[model samples]
Target: MITINNEPTAYTPIFLGTTQHSLRLSLEILIMVGMKLNDEIIETYNVSVSAIELGQLPDIGSEIAIDEITGSELSGFKAKLKQSDAKIQNTASTELEKLVDLKNVGRYQLLKGQKNMTQELNVPTLTNDNLILMRQMLGVTQKELSVTMGINEKTIRRIENKEQGISERFVNKLLAVYPELAQIIEVQFDWVSLTFPDLTSKQVIDDVLRLQDNLFLERPTSQNFYTREMAFAGEKNIYIQDFAPFKNPETQAIEQKFGTTLYLTGKGTRLFEKALLEQSMNWRNFFEKARQYRGHLTRLDIAINDKWGLLNMNDLVKAVQEKRFWSKSKSYAVHGN
Candidate 1:
């Protein structure tokens, strides 16, 4: 008798020795175990069968009740038995963790609903449940994800429903395509600075003002030369600076090193949104005009906030120590003890 939920089931499970022969399984039973049998041989099996009925089975060999075996005893039994190289698991979390090296890729951490952190950081795997939640958080539909990921909508639904499993390669591919999905909680572009080489300060100011709907220009102030601060909603401000005098080392002449520069912070993007709408321009249009004016992107900072402690800062420090990252800057400063 098989005991489930402390209740005995009439049917007993039988173990078979195939001896290199192909062993067939009942799809109905496999579905009941929340797993599928592939071509390879299987040694040990542990599953919950509450969802299905075991009607009939072939009498192959002696029956061993899982409840009768200890985990160490099972390990010994499994060691003596012939098993496939591929590891198989029925649960989504177990299967996903088996496929990927989570140590290499950062673990994903998330909270339940909008409350406390109920999940542990160690066993953080990108399960189908996480995928569904992430899509929902991103306010995207299954069809939209399918279109973006180039995966079949039905396939995504199947994975989410636990009818199918996704491979590690596919998981990495998905993350590569939609890097923002890894943010899991919140992602924001905090700082943006652009330099226009060809355009004068006046031209840059005029173009910026065209997009300014709620922004207020402050009184011009002098910081070496003339500078202005544009205050927007939420107390965010944009700093505009004209070229400053610099002695060219090669020419030994006083020249303007920096062109007209505009600094837009994360908060300032809020006001910039209104400016874009007022000017009937999207980000692409604005960038296009900047390119037309020979604008150069000087700096951009992406702020990823992990409220649930998903990212390990120690791993980043170790990566920097190992020189695993690449940067355009020659030197970087690491903060924290």
Candidate 2:
């Protein structure tokens, strides 16, 4: 009989076959045990006396000496039974430890598998999410951003949603405001292309008048006849001459009479090209410097020239004094240039 939860439970039968393949009538012994809680059928068998001499019975089982009436003999039998019970208990404990270890290993493997699955199923990219984050970081409303960028708010919404393709012009406008948006969007710098709108007739006239005012402010006697002619030519969609009346009086008189001159050789044309090239190069240098510095500054302090020959060198010294600039300088010295 076996005890479970302080109650007697039945032991089930275990069959062991012999080479003879026939039941041993002398070995048959009926054994009775208690039923388990689940009402499972139990059977038991008694060990044969002959099988004990052949070492078929386990050494831990109880041994009974027939007709033994001595107290010493009875005490020896009880000690052997206790030793057998201890051996069974130790075996059971060792098996329980192995099962616990296997369970822990299985749980760890399951967790690791779940982690790998999550990494594989991660989202593709964050282009749209980044666009929204950038817009929010700038602290500008969609309508305000549209006004500053000269684009419709609907277009901005579409870009944030990734539902519509972004045009180069719009991209450029965004970059101008938030330069780091390029890195966030994971777009190559050279892929950007911008097309500026042509000036309207009224805008041309206004620009010409503004230039006239500037020249008049600088020199009251100067009529800025060259600027007026260029404005008129621009309005008429005709090419203007490159005559510099201020520098050359003869060319100026001839231009005043002809009302037009070749556009290429004009001082304004040369100045315009030089300014444009300088501005473009400055922007390129600024981006390079920003990259070298790892985006440290909020604004670039590089010098840039305008079409009217206006030079801006407001913060060049401060930029050079920065630690990042010194680091770059050291690297350049160590290298060839």
Each candidate: what lDDT?
A: 0.47, 0.30
What TM-score goes with each of the models? 0.37, 0.18
Over 4 Å off, model 1: 1-187, 209-236, 243-259, 305-310, 333-337
Q: Looking at candidate 2, what is the lDDT of residue 134?
A: 53
Q: How accurate is candidate 1 locally (lDDT)?
A: 0.47
* Reference-based lDDT, residue 125, model 1: 56
Model 1 agreement with the true structure over 1-337: per-residue lDDT tens digits? 3343455544333432111101112222221010112321122333322111222221222342333221233442111111232223342332112212211123242422222234534435567887787778778899998898887899889989998877777677677777645544444445677887665445575764453322233444466453544432213345566654558899999865445677776544433443454455555577688887788778877555564345688897889888888899877778866
lDDT of 2: 0.30
| Candidate 2 lDDT over residue span 203-283, tens digit each | 222332122211111111123233433322122111232223334465544322222221222222222222223233332
Question: Which regions in candidate 2 have their CA more than 4 angstroms from the true location?
Answer: 1-126, 179-337
TM-score of 1: 0.37
TM-score of 2: 0.18
